[model samples]
Target: MPENDVIAAGARTVIRLPRPADQAEFLARVRDSAALHHPWLAPPATPADFRAYLERLTEPQTEGFLVCERESGALAGFVNINAIVRRAFLSGALGYAAFVPYAGRGHMSEGIGLVVRHAFTDLGLHRLEINVQPGNTASIALAKRAGFRLEGFSPDYLFIAGAWRDHERWALTAEMTADGPGAGR
Candidate 1:
């Protein structure tokens, strides 16, 4: 969307709202990242899917963030906050992926930090969680690196690919973070 919609930024990455104009490049990146995403994630790959994804973001409970390289503005990956609960809960779930060219380059690590900061500060969220399949070690590592603690495990937590998958729940509360709540603002 607008360039000014940046939620957060680091030295190498920037997180912002997804735009319709990014469809072509986004699809291509998804296609390229399919191998890495298999059995774990299934992001929007076609125009119709992308459109539907965008439409979902219009809802108050959902937010989609496109992580791009700061210097070149290349699509590094995507991180979504879904099923946000306000009022008593003030919590949200996280889902993220890094494109092939940017994977393992430490871009997503920085991006995840930015997302956590934005959720705590800008969004005024008190807690955030990431439900990742147990087999996905990389995703688990990312969550751990970003300061998320393993909460528990759920059998058949989310349906992915063709069947239900077991997942480990990782969480971070504002008070548990260094830059989170009670930090400065």
Candidate 2:
């Protein structure tokens, strides 16, 4: 497959794994949206960190992708599937964030839907989970829109923004959705 392909929805946006060449663009977006993302995705992200981040995405144990606007070809957001476990339980964690410019346009939701499909069908994962901070209403809505059910709140689940923040766990199982794994394909 090409480095990135545009996913068709009411609004066209490209979704695919980020290549090494995209590092500069990714860094620029992070810098530009520092204020909006700092609370959740703080600074101190050096070039090395970004390089390692991209490398992790290509690793067999994890996968990640960037969302871009088709018309402008700008880096709008990112999504990741991490902590893949293939033992008794084939499961992984889902994480995503969109730039301020792309927020509330439903682009992240569309990208997430495509990634969820690929995760279930292509990756053969049985379950996916997302943890969102209690205050992140946009992210919470994205999870719901993508069919993740709210499981419960996790106290001091993650240390973000210099403190341990509470997160609400949301999950989606392949068997729970009609279009999930082993449905027909």
Candidate 3:
């Protein structure tokens, strides 16, 4: 957890910045996970899209991390923090997707915990928020597991997949993480 160094390793997963070398493998995983993602997520399944995705994440206001299996160095999933506001209100929005053969294995839960810690301690972010579709129980569960509390709901909060979708807002403050959720457990 150093300046501009995006790596947070855990017992099973390693969360690090996405690289150009990961294009082929990441795209392959995205294609393989089509059904698993579908309406919930539409990651870059094509090489061109992947490049664009990477470019966007590399911007000053965003961060993209890949959760890789520690043993084999295979991609497990991805987490992106977008719209980071660093002045008075240090906050960002969280988005994540798990690839095939790795989904439901709890890698994301662990990676998210690491990311949350990094965002609070290293990045000096005061708050983080996750917006999940109500029908996506898995995403909601992941957020809750990472200590994000239910904040509220917004109807048609975002436009995705050709339609406006309602989303449940879940958030966690750095103070909350330091005091209760991820303090000493």
Candidate 4:
């Protein structure tokens, strides 16, 4: 995406919507990172799948972003705000993944920070949540580093890989960050 299309940008990365032009690179990255994503989440793996996934993001309640490296314009990973609820709740759930080439490089951490700011400021969301399977240490760490507090645990929160998986619920309200009500941006 062009800089103008970036929804958010950190020092090392930028977040933008996945476009049709990105299908090849995005799919290649996903294919290379399959080992890294196994048993946790499944991203778009085919052209048809990408088209379907992009179509889903057009819904009013869902937003998806691709975290890209600023220097090389490569796909770092993806972050999505899913199941957004308006009215009284004004919240959304976050889902993210770091591709093999970019894992452990801190790009995702910065991307998430940008996402948090965008969620609170641009999207007018009051809360953002992340659910992680118990064994996914990397995901849990990323959420923690992004300032999402562990709220509780769900015995069978989601179905992943096959059966129902237990997940730890982590959340961050707008008030928890610098952009809290009455605070200066």
- Cα lDDT, all candidates: 0.92, 0.79, 0.88, 0.93
TM-scores of the candidates in the order shown: 0.96, 0.87, 0.92, 0.97
Tell me the alpha-carbon RMSD of every candidate. Answer: 1.5, 2.7, 3.1, 1.2
For model 4, the superposed segments whose C-alpha errors exceed 4 Å read: none
The number of clashing residue pairs in each candidate reads 0, 0, 0, 0
Ranking by TM-score: 4, 1, 3, 2
lDDT per residue for candidate 2 within 1-185, as digits (tens), equals: 35335433225676777777888878877777787775765632578988888777777779887777766777778888989999778899988888767877877887888778777877889899999988887788889998999999989898887899889999999898777646777
Q: Model 3 shows how many backbone clashes? A: 0
Q: lDDT at 22 for candidate 4? A: 90
TM-score of 2: 0.87
Residue pairs in steric clash, candidate 3? none
Look at candidate 2 and tell me the lDDT of residue 82: 85
Q: List the residue pairs that clash in candidate 1.
A: none
Total backbone collisions, model 2: 0
Per-residue C-alpha lDDT of model 1 across residues 47-149, encoded as one tens digit per residue: 9999999999999998889899998899999999999999999999999999989999999999888988888888889999999999999999999999999
TM-score: which candidate is best? 4
Off by over 4 Å in 2: 1-11, 181-185
Model 2: weakest 10-residue lDDT segment is: 1-10
